[model samples]
Structures are given as C-alpha cells and as structure tokens.
Target: MKIPHKAHVALVDGERFLFLRNDGQIFDPKLSKVEEPDLEATNFSAGVKHQDQGGQISGSTDLNELAHAAAAAEWLNAKALANAFDELVVVADPKTLGEMRRHYHKELEKRLVGEVDKALTHEPLEKIGEVLANA
Candidate 1:
C-alpha cells in the first residue's frame, strides 16, 4: 500500500479519528497531521434499514459508538461530494470500516485508494506510516 504523495489518510475508530497527509514519496511517506473537519454524530433510531445493503440495522450493544461511526462515514461522504481530496486512504477498525462501506458515496469510492481493517487511530504517526509502507 504505497501512499501517493500528498494523499489524504484517515485513521478512524468509533471514538477517535486522525487526518493526515503524505508529504513524501509513495514508498517513503512522511505523514503530517491535518485539521479534521468539524464532525457531529448522526442520530439513528433502532432498526433503521441500510438501503444500500438491504439489511435491517439491529441496535448495537454500543449504540453511541455506532452513531459515531455513522457520523464519520457521513463526514467522509460530504468530503467526497466536495472533492476535498484527490486520493484517500482509510485505516479503521473493522466495525467502523463496515459502517463506512454501507454509506460510501460513489465519488468517495472513486477516490479511495486503499482501506485497512485495523484499529490504527491511536497509533503514532511514524508507526502508522511504517505499517502502511509495509502493507
């Protein structure tokens, strides 16, 4: 998973998210933190259907966390609609990734370069770069 130069990288989880940019070359990425857009949790009631997946969303044990993940996906969708970045990579926990997948806008899908289903939100920037370089 070589991160293209200046590519936007989002490391997200249910509770935390880090926005970064790769300033170096594809194989040797220098990740620099970037300010994230103001994000608000989406309020979803229990049993709401997922239109794209054609599945009922049963209540999660951690409803708040699920809402937060939905919020992250919404933010990403908004960014995609705005053409905020040309290339995007997502590194998120499995649950968050799945939630995001259900809500991804077509534009976001086009710009997405890679996704890693792991919880990397808390990892240091250097560690994240290393992992991505080897991915």
Candidate 2:
C-alpha cells in the first residue's frame, strides 16, 4: 500500500520500535526471517519477520480488534500495518526528536500556514524555529 508523504512510518515488533522517514520515496526492506517450530504453536498469524518453518506472525491491525469486529479482521492487512515504515533510521538523540514532534510540529505547521509554500526547497530545517517565530 502507498502511504502518504505526510504519514510517518514506525517499525514496531512487540515491545520494541524504530522510526522511519517517509521522504516521499519508495523503499524495499531487506528483511531477515526466523524459523518457527510449529504453526499450531502460534498465537498470532504472519509476523513482520519472515518464518521459514511455521511462517510469520502479524501484529498491526486496522481500527483495532476490540475497536471493530470480525469483519475488520477478515478484511484488513495486519502485517503491513504492524510493521510500518519503509526504512528504520536510528536517531542519535531520540528524546530531542520526540520533544520536537510532540511540542513543535503542529505549532510550526499551524503558525506557518500559507507562508510555507517553498518550505521544502528554500527553508533550512534547522531554521524552522525562525519561520515558526516569524508567524
């Protein structure tokens, strides 16, 4: 499925997660698979990691299961939604990035409005603070 340029990708595997950039580019994940002992032993179906023996188990579900119904489970692609993000780029400082996104992104977007027409090309991302302040 094609995700929007604006949409963020997060590669989540159970308790762990990695964040990826959309960058309006298509990428193929060079995934590594693990072999499961038996298919009957599985609690979930089709994981993000490949399984040579019993097959992968999936996690990500659309609309949430209890949030929806059986028809939703039958229809939605769980694996793709769960193992999101084309590429997982490790950030040096996660706390800072989280703070920026949580505290600044929306305010920057809201403050910039129509003035950000040439934003991607002209404005240096480092200078976002200036643009946001200008608004």
Candidate 3:
C-alpha cells in the first residue's frame, strides 16, 4: 500500500523513539523531527526479587514496566499527531510493537496507516524512507 503523503512516522525501540513527518515529496520525501524522548533515563527495573516454582530465586527485570513506558510514549505521540495529521505509520521493534498494539487508543488505532515490525531506531534518517518503502 502507498504511504499517505505528509503522514507522521514514528520509529520506536525499547529505549528510544523518533517522530518524523513526511514532507509529501516523491522519492525525495523530506522527514522532519518532531520529538525524541529521553527513554534511556526512564528506568524499567523493578529492583525486586522473585521465587520460581522450583524454589529458585531471580532478580526479575520489570518488562511490563518497560512496555508500559513505551506504550505511554506512543500514546503521547499519537495524541500529538491526532490534531495535525490524518495518518500515522509506526516502525517499531517486535516487542515494542506488541506493547503499542496493546495500549493504543481507539483514536490512534483509527489513524494508523501502516506498521513495520523492525527496529529502525539506530538507522540513519536518510535511510528510513527507503526502509519503509521496502517493507
């Protein structure tokens, strides 16, 4: 399917996110940054211990907490886009993508135009469009 012109694109991972707006150009579509949150500073550790069925003990990292934080960020981004854009594309790692799906608001879900289950947070800005196009 063709990506909508001037749609908002969100690149997200477990610990970082980038918001870009498509400029509606041809192969030379311009993407401008709208926001990048400091996800590294947001701790997802539970700092607690748990016992397994085998009586084994482990210091469990709170994956749920991480997912919640990531979902919240996505929600905020979606809310911001709701007013300015009619479509949104999300490119997220598999784990974060699941979290986003679980927490997406009805309004955001309605505006979703596309989704890519790949981690592109570390890719260069110039390559994002190419990646999305290929996906």
Question: In model 2, what are the clashing residue pairs, if there are any?
Answer: 45-58, 46-56, 46-57, 46-58, 47-56, 47-57, 47-58
lDDT of 3 by residue, 1-135 (tens): 346668888888766778788875644546778877554323233211222433333423345445544555555555755575678888887766766676576777778888999888888877888777766
List the candidate 3 regions with Cα displacement exceeding 4 Å. Answer: 26-28, 39-65, 72-74, 77-82
Q: What's the candidate order when arranged by decreasing TM-score?
A: 1, 3, 2
Task: Provide C-alpha RMSD values for all models, in order.
Answer: 4.3, 18.2, 4.9
True-structure RMSD for candidate 2: 18.2
For model 1, how does the per-residue alpha-carbon lDDT over 1-135 read when each residue is reduced to its tens digit?
879999999888878877889998999989999966556776554114433343325434455566777777778888779988899999998877887787788998999999989898888899999999998
Best by TM-score: 1
Point out the higher-scoring one by TM-score: 1 or 3: 1
Estimated TM-score for each candidate: 0.85, 0.20, 0.71
2 versus 3: better TM-score goes to: 3
In lDDT terms, which candidate is top?
A: 1
Error of 2 at 124 (Å): 28
Which regions of candidate 2 deviate over 4 angstroms?
A: 26-135
List, residue by residue over 1-135, the lDDT tens digit for candidate 2.
333343333322222223333344323222222211111212233222233444323533322211222222211123234543222221212322222222222323332112111122122333422332343
Compared with the true structure, all predictions reach lDDT values of 0.80, 0.26, 0.66
**Residue 84 displacement in candidate 3 (angstroms):** 3.7
